[model samples]
Target: MVGMEADGKMGVHLDVSTPGYAGRLEVVEGPTGRRVRSASEKARIAAESLMPGAQVSAIARKHGATRWQIYDWRLRLRLGELVLPESQEPLFAPLLVEEAPLPRVTPKPPKSAPAKVEIAINGMVIRTTVEVEQLAQVIRAVRASR
Candidate 1:
């Protein structure tokens, strides 16, 4: 009989009266061999890992793979080493372009009157809108005349 022992180990127990009976049995633990996956299957799993909001660790666990394997597969896909089937190609909605509205035009305000400056030097008043440099020359000429 094959059964689990009290310590949680699996073992085979046989009756001593059985014919050709073995006195002992050997128990092996863990996986006896590595699992092999096909290229297409790996590609599919790799593509799924690239989906938005898809968790790499969860995808790896679901497909009996490690996170590193998923990442490697993604890299291979990017490098063109792995090709996705035609049906797996991404689809996009048609883009529609519409004409934008013209911007509104605003009327500019009326130009303000030019400011007038009056200078009084030696009781001789001079009123002009000339620039400061020209006014400085005039002031020098006026002072030199006095």
Candidate 2:
């Protein structure tokens, strides 16, 4: 604020407090800007976030990180880019399968009745219990005799 201009003019004054002027500009360093986190550190934070009932936002605040960062780390862990400590390998719940009861047996279909044929010709009635082909032959003979 005290330096003179290169051309020997009076020192310039910045009128920053004009109408509709916002507050002075400030550089807010976000999580990515403030520091660099190593893979191991990120893995640790991600593991902590996975604990029962652990909230990602709370974990991020505890480690001075953003929720997105923790989420990214979790994704990396899922993709195998990040590995958990040997003592903390993932655990799967035990499977307990029981034998299911046998399904109900459907009753066998009722036996079908044998086919019977009856023929009437010229006041004579013929009743026979035989296959369709035999019946047809008998009917042809009777017609020929007539």
lDDT of 2 at 83: 79
Candidate 1 colliding pairs? none
Best by lDDT: 2
Off by over 4 Å in 2: 1-33, 87-146
Residues 31-119, model 2: lDDT tens digits:
65576878877887888888778899999999989999999999998888987667865643467999999999997655555458777
Name the best candidate (by TM-score): 1
lDDT over C-alpha atoms for residue 58 of model 2:
100
Each model's Cα RMSD? 10.6, 10.7
TM-score of each: 0.42, 0.40
Give, for candidate 1, the lowest lDDT window spanning 10 residues. Answer: 1-10
| Candidate 1 vs. true structure, TM-score | 0.42
